[model samples]
Target: MHGIEIAVSTVIFALRDDPRNDCTALGMPLVRRVRQPYEGSWALPGGPVRPDEDLTDTARRTLVETTALSPTYLEQLYTFGHVDRASKPVPGPRVISVVYWALVRPEEAERGIEDDNVAWHAADHPPELAFDHATIVDYALWRLRTKMEYSRIAQAFLGETFTLAQLRQVYEVVLQRTLDPANFRRQVESSGGVEPTGEYLVGGRHRPPKLYRHRAASDLADNGPLTRL
Candidate 1:
């Protein structure tokens, strides 16, 4: 009788230029399978879980080995283990995948490997993927968009300090909507989630804009007790 096999996968998002529109958009790296059930199809960066490694470690290792990415914001997303999740013409045992979602700044995203097998693609409009990866990608994107509304998760896409306009762009790109500059600035200021860094960004053609940083009291995401993790 076939037994269950455990694996780990990651959905890593980054803000980059959308090749389709030439505007900032969410993208993720995918690896093409070289063999077996879904050979030659794009899939998430992942591999089997090692006996000595925990789920998160396996997720991180696979990311580095497959795409050369090591995101700072990594969290357990969800588990997928439907009985038919791995069904195929080729013989294979049942697979239980523990999925993790990660966010990386654009600079970090550039570290990913781009080649015949690994490449970045628009996360919102991924190509035909192997297995149920399309479903998994949709779920991860939904979670990120939902959390972007009420959490400071947007900061994950930016650096240490940024102007209100820069921060708003992150929101616009991820949320896929334009926000009024004046209204957005007012709302962000009133939220108390960010504080002025008392520094101005120089070298811009227009007047320098004040830089702001995420407040220490506010965590990236409200993961309850897991906030410390």
Candidate 2:
């Protein structure tokens, strides 16, 4: 009889600003595994699949189980299966894993997860991760960066009805570079991703700033896209 093992893992990404880029660039979260074969080591959230469960079902279930976080955007990223990955266990077959990329809203992130030990690190400077997780994260981020440049995915980083400045922050963080405000605003207008509310808020230390909400359809479509992060 042939036997196979399946597991689901997640690469959860959030927007974070770092001073290295002059308060630019964002990062993701990587949790430490408490199990053997990599016990007390850092890795993405993952768990073995139970019988009769689908690949994504395992990923979603594992996310809540480990992080107490329900990902707002969840999509299958990739599948990894290589020789010697499970050579330790005698008679054990190849272990195949399906990794997912998920994005969490800023508020949801601030609310945070139940696991206090989970540490959120900058994506550009990730720690030594267990197994092949570093490679996994790299791929996921590349996909996000590529998609963001052309698509309006960067809007996911902001709240409803945000100012041009807020939208620019998302790009700066993800790209790890400063965006020309004029060029950014021009591009945003052409994309039709946001519309001005003709309303301004005056709570900051400076003058009131204009606000705009990301189009509703764009938000919904984000939930539908199969992404790695």
**Best TM-score goes to which candidate?**
1
Q: What are the runs in model 1 whose C-alpha is more than 4 Å off?
A: 19-21, 112-115, 227-229
Off by over 4 Å in 2: 17-25, 86-93, 202-206, 219-229
- Each candidate structure's TM-score, on Cα atoms with residue i matched to residue i, is 0.93, 0.84
Worst 10 residues of 1 by lDDT: 220-229
The models' CA-based lDDT, in order, is: 0.88, 0.77
- Candidate 2 residue 210 C-alpha distance from true site, Å: 1.5
The alpha-carbon RMSD values of the candidates against the true structure, listed in the order shown, are 1.9, 3.7
The residue-by-residue lDDT of candidate 1 on 1-229, one tens digit each, is 5689999999989988756767888889999999978999999999999999988899999988988877868888999999888876566789999999988888888665767799999898899999899999999989998998888898888888889998999889888899999999999989998999999987855878999998988767567986665
Q: Each candidate: how many clashes?
A: 0, 4
Q: Report how far residue 187 has shifted in candidate 2, in Å.
A: 0.5
- Give lDDT: candidate 1, residue 224: 91
> What TM-score would you give candidate 1 relative to the actual structure?
0.93
What is candidate 2's CA lDDT for residue 131?
Answer: 74
